[model samples]
Target: MAYLYYGADARPAEIPDHVLAHVKVVAATKLRRGESFMLTWRHRGEGTGGRTSLWMQPSIPLRFVFDEPEPEALDSEYLRKLANEATSSRGIVLEWDDEAIVGHPGEAPPIDAMAA
Candidate 1:
């Protein structure tokens, strides 16, 4: 499965509902705005011998996926909720590094690189 990483905070599971909603909104807005950007993150862990962490950031091209597109109207309440969520998220600001290995499914490639 493909994964989306939010680097600023580095706590994926701790994202609040409001922030998630805002992310969806931001993604949708970016798609509408014709803006595509790369998000990167790092993974750290300890193996049998020692501790290690790798900085592997991937660049992804995101397109708007609309089953039923909504009108280009921004809901104030929703926007506020999203803003609050983003504030709470406090995600880290990561520099863009376009060096990620794409991974594919149904074929076992390297255990590290994932299909884009």
Candidate 2:
């Protein structure tokens, strides 16, 4: 699990590394344009399991820590969708789906399996 240390206080927001990578890109693009937005995601794992939202601003500090040594291979298709959603009233999302994640047991499925 990767942690997103947001703002000065630095509360770690636990997220899957791949998902965080996508969010990082979107946040950077929007922030560079001087746009402030909200990032919302439901809590995973054993906890209250509701959601958390952060106001992402250009000036605020954000640190993305990955457990994996290598950076994730980004999916442009997902990035485009996420970027589009970030511009909406709903803001950027950290939710996961088929493409947004690797696969069960942290291993990507074979192409043939995916096709099925």
Candidate that would win on lDDT: 2
- Full-model lDDT for every candidate: 0.32, 0.74
lDDT of 2 at 58: 90
By TM-score, the best candidate is: 2
lDDT of 1 by residue, 10-94 (tens): 4342222322233456455443555443322243234533222223223333322223343233334444433343334332222
Q: Model 2, range 43-83, lDDT digits (tens) per residue?
A: 77666668998989999988899999987766666676677
Off by over 4 Å in 1: 1-14, 37-116
Q: TM-score for candidate 1, please give it.
A: 0.27
